[model samples]
Target: MSKGRLLDGVSPIEGISPTDSLDTLFLKSGSSTAHSPQSLRAKPWPARPQQLCKGIRGWRWWDSALDVVVVMLPIPFFVLAAAVIFVNGKIVDQEQFTILNHSIKGATTLFPICFAAITGRAAIKFATWKLEQGTTIGVLEQLMGSRTVASALTTQVQLRSFNVIGLLMIFVWSLSPLGAQSILHILYTPVLPTSTASSVAYMNSRQQSYSDPRPSSSFPGQWFNSLAIEMGSMLIAPTEVKISSMDINGNVKIPCQSSLLASGTPDSEGWVQTALMNATSNGSLVWSSLFGIPIELGTKLGNTTFSIESTYIELSCNNKTVESLEPDGQNGPRINFTYVSVAGPYFSAEDPDPLDPWIIGYRGVDITTYNDTDGSAYVFPLFCPDCLSSNFANKTIEAGTIAFQEFEGLDNANATTVFCNPYQRYVESEVSCMKTAATQQCQVTAQRDSVLPHMPPEITYLSFPLVALGLSALLPNVTPIHDATNEVQNYLVYDPLDPLTIMGEDNSVLTSGGSTPKFLSDVALSDIETRLGQILNAFVYGSTWNASIFLLGESIDNLQGHEFGGKNASFVPATRADIVAMIQNQTAAFTVPAVLRTQAQVYVCNFAWLGVFLFSTVVMLIGAITGVVFSRKTIVPDYLGYVSSLAKESPWIRMPDVGVNMDGMDKARLVKEVKVRLGDVSYVYGGYSEIGRLAFARLEETTKVKKGKLYV
Candidate 1:
């Protein structure tokens, strides 16, 4: 054999002796005088042994490569996931302020955390090895030799594969529809606009049309006539004359002609007896004729060509002559008389006879152009008056066109002019009056009763004049105007001292004797009367002769000439058919609000997906850099070097074997015998140098010796 090579392919310098300590052999080789084995046995061990790690895997280029693969493998997957997330983020961010947008943003933030947690486990395991400077298989390597342990362990490799596979799977799943949807929401869901509108609808029906059951107002027009004589030479010039006029074929005419002048005097008793016959023959119109004087007394008016002007008279209460009517003549007593005629019930603003049509119109249309998105709904209102006003001259929607199809009317300016303005004003005034009356009545009624009944139309249209308007003359003969006026005065002029007045107590037939229930609270009754009187005063002003004529003419014209003219007529009581026609011709007008209508939607803008993707890519790169910089190589045990040396040195021994202790033997002797037997057996099996070519050769079994055979 060559001097440089040893048996079993080990070099001579690397070889160790099995029979003796290798240190003793080396010392002997160096000594000049050769000492026997007895002298070597007297030497103690060189130094105490120290506990050190052994047979552990060490750092290698291949191990670093594996760790680098672990860190880099998921980077591409993370990049792909980031791209998808960025796209989803762009989609949701563009749709901001919605619930879905918020959800998508949250998901985008959460995905990274989820990935970190899932892969962090493997990272933690790798970190443990570097931090502790040990491996879980270190003890096994020491017992079985590093070569056997290295081939048996595959834990780290499997863990690296697990993390890579998980990252790839998560990345692939993120591209799915569900994953994308979780990142962002997109749908053409229609949403309501940020505004709304409302409109007023007019009452256009009158099913139960008839006279009011309550005491009805005679009429709303003015009547001009006279109580004085018209043909007679002599008559009384009265303070004022109340006239009762009739509408005969739409013309106002008084049935009786009364004059303010009443001339001639009545005769006394002696003249009555002497000149009664002569006076009757002479045909002179006298005041005695109005007093119901007999012909024998010669007190009668001689001329009977015309009837008496007075409707009623009261002469029974006058016992003296001068106490009677002195207005006709001052010479003798004539008659105490009262003239009844129609006075102004007057036009009421509250109960306008001819109400015009007015209203507000509201419309809600889809505003697709809002936010430049798919579509949204918006609402807006258009006041009819405002629309009709000059402020919207250019914006007025033409009637009868497609835009104004819902409205009922011709596009003629004449019709709109007549109805929209004059009639509209009428209707507005009536409505305002109605509202005021309703409020005032409600207040009074509430004070009297707990629950309010439905307002009666009589109260709605009833006009109670504050002053004794010709209305008192219109009352039936059963009730005297003077008596009512006196009683009303009592109720009007408040006296705090009187309990009955304060209590609103009344003995009048209007409340007593089953006529009607009287109000207990005088305050409440007075308030009601005052309010009603004011409302009537307002009503009477609006119900004038000229107004009545105009209203009647307009009604007739609309019903006969225009289509849908009477569609929105008022339910107000009309004494004449012409008046009803006026109310019927009214119509509530409206215009489409320009705000609700919008231009068509057009989505021509793109999302910021590309920008977001680039940003995410940058973030991913930062993450990769951080991961690479922070990463630590796994700390393999030192047993790897020992295994490499062993493989290089020896081929026969694959592992070290330790024997158990034997019982019933000297412990120290057994230990020495075990070492000596192993050494001798190894030498017999194979020599250190391959040149010797020694092998195990046994001829026969050796004889066993007992304790007796040995010397004592």
Candidate 2:
């Protein structure tokens, strides 16, 4: 073959025979100054045919497009992920959130590898193109073609001079980790509390009817008898049992508002009496017309909070020994009870024509007997009258003249006379109700101290009847004077001052017969006051039963219509249907606005981290596009940085040179059968050999190095 130029501006080494093989020339010029590794010159060979130079170029416009598409593939995935997080700020389902997160994570991991492949290929093309332009294999050139992040970083630091391509290569490789972390951290699911607007049904007492009219002569015979029987059952039931029953039947808890009476006083009972008196005088009592309405039930909200208006009666009393007494011999030795039988201020003012006998007043006698002997015994009678009122304000009452003229036993008598003033109050309160996990609870948060305006007439009318029923059912009856039978016969009466009589004996208070009994002198004043307060509480608590019964509207007609003789009979009590119709005719179903809160897993997007990811993505896309544009004209196989590619045309190993301009894939297919290895490939001169150099060469020419052997 004739000697010719293998590269531009290069010739074979001087005095070298043109007929010698290229390897012989390489070994011969190893010691020469012009052909050293640091300043190597391309070897001469036979000139290539013009047709070979015109063979198909490795890269095409379509190849560049493919590279750009690979780099841009992950962008849509990122956008989709961001949109999902932004659209649904909260994710309630765990599986969907996890699946979305995993998809993003997989994309995040895949993008960097794809980016490196495309850019790394472009980098190899750029380096080869520079060599084709006759540029030397310098540090910047080597760094621009580096594929790994560590090498890229090292190359970046070693760059003492500014080169746009080198800096861009470093920048591109740096984004791998940054973009990955950004994508990984961009979305996270956190458990957070969220609320939605909801509504709940609540008892709206303000909307109930406040009117019930009956003639004075028909008061005891009409609705009063049924109310008394119902009150009787209520009085017999324990307070705790009543409360528990309310909870079970209503699906709601009605907490008592006894705290309204908790004014730090030695005698809370006496304090209540005084307060009630003051309230009645000043007309400051708070009243609710529909006092016994049940709260609406069955709300299916997750966790709700709302406020409602409610009312309950509170009772207080004062019990003390009478310091002075005057007697009148009407029938027998007894104390007479007296009070004006008129509805309170609220009722009288609001009623168009107030019923005359709606309010109850006592005009009866209580007799006491000591030692069962006429001369030696002392009489100390106590009487408690039904002083029911429609008014929630303060009021006072006084006892009538006692029939006993004198005390027979004087200072030595063991019995003592006692007086009691029981006070009832109408409490308007703001109750807060919360329903969580299908259970509802209510508590009285505040009470109205001053009277509210526009008291419902139904509340006033029902208040008198309720108080009267409570008093009669729970308290011992007082004996009235009979004109025909002037003889006053006392029956066994349970003393209200005795706790044992109230709590220990089931039949003591509920079944006790006629006249109010005398309080024993041995009973403490505190015990007397406590027992009176308890009786009053039992009276007020009857409203809870009324509420429950009213909730059982129309059903009671079936249960009690025949029991009351007949529904339409004049002697029959007002039916549950009548009361329900009277109250609910004009009212809308009560409801209140509430906030329903529930815990959910929320997809929170960290835009700052997302911005970093997008920044890296945009930079990488620009870099990839730039690479494609800059390497469009390259005309060499993708042979950079590959040991197999390096083995071709190596001085120690001979191979055909026809594939230099072919694509790497085509070249790889052609050389798939060629075997190569990293081994000893030392040059021998004048029968002397130096340290072996490790290089990839043909299997026939190379010797596999031992495991422990070292080579240059």
Candidate 3:
């Protein structure tokens, strides 16, 4: 035997005794084999027939490598998934930012807790030399015990794998279609620059379509734009045919300044100015592509902000455009080629022409050149409305595109105007060919200025004064305007009070206060009297008191002739002759004494109260009688409202009935046989009902005379 590894092989434990060894063998048998010494064998004998495939084969495949991996890979994932469920349960999003805040907290807390628990278990087991029982520690301690430190790299190696696997799964999730959608929302958020703090931002589908200066060149020289909706896609080409250096139709080689508009006398729509103002009170918003756009002051107010976008002169000119106004002859006809930055006396520091803000920056004619006509793309403009208002004379209004190809001739009267943008367009003169450069295409750019001005549309949320407006919608504006002269009077100067008047000392009160006038001028009074009678024309209508209890159901009885009476069910019977005398003879009816009415009320009230007393007394007596008859359980509050459907066995308490005999012999009988005997048991009945509580007790003491054999 190897002396160095005695306990590792067959050596007995240092603490084990001879008898304890035998006890172990007996316990291993599990048969409770504490029989005689001869019966306790080293191994038990058994015969089995009912079962085959004795041990489960799956347990045989479990090995060290399998255990290590299980402790690592799948265990981590399973643990992670379970942690996710706990994480979901813990997220308390009662506010807007809680979702993001809790997510970070959850990740931080979960990792530390799992690591500490797992490490602590390993440490405790190693110190004690233990599994659940006996002396055997876990594998983690074996790895952590390494002295070289490099040997402890198992911890690092294992954790690195976990991170790599987690990262792989994250990448897979991001590539999914659902992940792409989440990314887009964070990137492109909508907001309206001109609305209040409570407002939202949106460019209508129509306006968005017009926003793109260059769309596909399919519809040549076709300009589509609208004031309310987006700038729709359009294809700009020359209006008249001119076969110069290149082909006219299929692929034309034209100069960059080719006119898309025509020329004649400048029409107002052609040459006009426009100013657009967009602002928001608070909250920083991006209009996607525009960065650092100028924010104006006049339109902004205190908390509000405004943004400006500028673009100028986007059309070719013909000799029909006229002479250059600028000193430089290098400039085109009129002020065309002169990229005028901005005229002075136009804007200032304190209030930049509430309409225009940006100081135009025109680096001469650094034009937007297009090499391929079909290569049009929609790039968002880097400009704000305030800046652009100063640069461009007017709006580059455009319209319909592919998305709106089918919706034409939409009506605004009945159909929802929100979804449609159709134009009833008009102009002062015919569109000039100079604006289009005679390119045989519908280059319907405004004729006068390259862009013409348009008045800002009304910024009303709803029309027709929003159904009802101002204080009248929810409350009356109490503007107490008392009239000096009353035109409409309710009272005549010397008239007597009506017999029905409830106010003391009153002529009908005049409407001389508040908005009602006190004096009636003869001219208006004559008109009123001619329309009315010379006398008053009363506007008669019934008024309701909402004391409907007086008019409906049994409540009508509540109002039964209680003039001043204090009685219940009391009234003097008046004969038909008496009623007849009273009605036809008003003098006698008026003479009826008030004392008689008081007497009627007194009688009725006394009778009603007596009835109530009688009813309450009867109910109390009934409740007392029932309470004494049932068990103590009946008196208890627990069973007051609850009743069992099952019947309980009846209890029998003896009562003494006087016995009578037919002959000389008197006899006694037991009405109930005694079953359960208890001394503290009690019974109750009538006043003697308390004796039912002692009914069984009185039985033994009762004296009874019996006829005995030969008794003297």
Which residue pairs in candidate 2 have backbone atoms (N, alpha carbon, C) closer than 3 angstroms, thus clashing? 210-457, 210-458, 211-458, 279-393, 279-394, 280-393, 280-394, 281-394
Instruction: Give all candidate RMSDs, comma-separated.
Output: 31.8, 14.8, 40.7
The alpha-carbon deviation from the true structure for residue 662 of candidate 3, after best TM-score superposition, in angstroms, is: 91
Best of the two (1, 3) by lDDT: 1
Best by lDDT: 2
* Deviation in Å, model 3, residue 459 alpha carbon: 27
* Comparison by TM-score, 2 against 3, better one: 2
- lDDT by residue for model 1 (1-712), tens: 2232333433333344554333343243342233222322332322343332211233345635755664564455345444444443122234443544454466556545433432332333333343345444433222122112122123323333334433433343233223333334222223222221211112211111111112343232221111111101011111111111111111111110011012222234111111223322442212111111000101121111101011111011111111112222544222222211121121111211011111111111111121234322222212112112233323322121000001111111110100010001111100000012122100000001101111211111111221122222221111122322222223223332233442343322222334332221233432323322322222222222222221232232222233332233222223234333332333211111111211222222123543443344344344344434433333322222222223222322211221111111222222232211101112221333332321111111011223333210
CA RMSD (A), model 1 = 31.8
lDDT by residue for model 2 (1-712), tens: 2222222222222222336554564555343433223211133322352232312354456665676686676567557556665645664566776777677778787868866776676677667667666776664355453687777767656655447756766777888877877787777777777776665554323232211222333323443344344433333334342333132233232223343344323232232221333433442322221113344434453555544443333222233233322232543222212221123211111211111101122212111221233422112311111112224223322221111111112122221333443333333334445556666555333444324332321222123332333233222221122221100111112342232333333221122345332323445544434433433332333223223234333222233223221121111222334323322332222345555666766777888887888787776666566556655665554556655466554654444454445555555555566666677644322111334456565554457776665556
Candidate 2 — which residues are off by over 4 angstroms? Answer: 1-68, 76-92, 104-112, 118-145, 154-199, 210-303, 309-440, 444-588, 591-593, 598-712
Sorting all predicted structures by lDDT, with the top scorer first, yields 2, 1, 3
Return the lDDT, model 1, position 268: 41
Per-residue CA lDDT of candidate 3, range 77-194, in tens? 2332333334332213245225433543443344333333333223322322222224322242332332122323444354443344233323322222222222222211122222
